[model samples]
Target: MKKDDNAFGVEEAADSPGFLLWQVTSLWQREIRKALEKYDLTHSQFVLLASTMWLMQQGEPVTQILLSAHSKIDPMTTSTVLRTLQTKGLLERKEHTTDTRAKTVALTTTGEKLARQAIKTVEQFDTDFFQALGSKLGDFNKKLRLLLQQ
Candidate 1:
């Protein structure tokens, strides 16, 4: 094959945004896994737990569907995770007062405490992980939000 005859449009892998994003995301998730080890929570569990606590604080009844949407996790996965959390004694699933088809989720006392603690740890990890971007972090976040909007 010719020196320039490769499948990639970019001359180098480093120039591909998707590739870079994959690499960075992998590294970030690895560290987050380590950070959450003490809490005995996987990243998904922490996300759902924290999200449930946050939504509850807003005085809105948080249902499984709502939590799934908020966390960007699919309904099936959300259900499975919720079941796991319930089994772990971290959360409770109850019939919604108004919706017969929907079940509301709430963190138990232990779950709430663990969620708060894990959130602090994850937030600190994020701060440190993204600190290299420094002042550009806001712009980076905005760009990410824009991508999400797409």
Candidate 2:
């Protein structure tokens, strides 16, 4: 008998971790996009904004480079997103007190309110999405963390 040959390989497509991960990620993104819609923010916008606000809550000024690193967002993309956030009056980038070449970021009052609300919405979506794993979610999260570390 000829060896089974399929476009994705002999193994079933659903058995491929990469393919399953991609499908899961796409589905999660779609859900997050919908969850964020009421706030008039895109998933990327919410990530950058929420990350920035959370960082500032640590009592330190946040910069574009720092936010980029913390959020794992590219520097150029971070800059563009920051500009968009600024236009929405959600955040402000002011000159760093000690660094003339750097700008520190802060959330406006409106930004803080929206960020908190958005955070709640996103968190609920995450809980609902992962609830299927039940108690096994912790193990699944650890596996994801290990993969990220690699």
Candidate 3:
């Protein structure tokens, strides 16, 4: 270990894949944050609401656990965000029909409307952001999926 070398052995932060990923992710998140600002929602809140609405459309009785799993968000965080959404009049948590201890969630009328509007804004932003990839977005996405698999 030379005195000037990073303890983790990367010659430079710029050469580290993890560091580069973090940088890209942070910049992308900033863009998303800007787009979501008009809706008065945080990224996590938007993700949970959007995921719940999508899952509910596929079937009935969407539970918090189901939403968390579907959104790839942690259960604890999902619970907290759902409560906030409920308070905001966007959703409600009710006792599960089948599970005694679990709770089911559904979007309120206002919640569904906001979710739809937010989806449009988010989709537009995503299209413009990824347009830089031109014809290679499929390959880029495939590589991202491969990384997730690993």
Which candidate's TM-score is highest?
Answer: 1
Global Cα RMSD, each model = 1.1, 1.7, 2.2
lDDT of 1 by residue, 1-150 (tens): 674677987778998899999999999999999999999999999999999999999999999999999999999999999999999999999999999999999999999999999999999999999999999999999999998998
lDDT of 2: 0.90
Residue 99 alpha-carbon offset, candidate 3, angstroms: 0.4
Candidate that beats the other on TM-score, 2 or 3, i.e. the better one: 2
Candidate 3 per-residue C-alpha lDDT over 59-96 given as tens digits, one digit per residue, 9 for 90 to 100: 87899899988888899999999999999999999998
The window of 10 residues in a row where model 2 has the poorest summed lDDT is 1-10
Q: Which model, 1 or 3, shows the larger lDDT?
A: 1
lDDT of 2 by residue, 39-91 (tens): 99988789888998889989888999899989888989998998999999999
lDDT of 2 at 51: 92
Rank order by TM-score, top first?
Answer: 1, 2, 3
What are the clashing pairs of model 3? none
Q: Could you give me the TM-score of model 3 versus the true structure?
A: 0.90
Better of 1 and 2 by TM-score: 1
Clashing pairs in 2: none
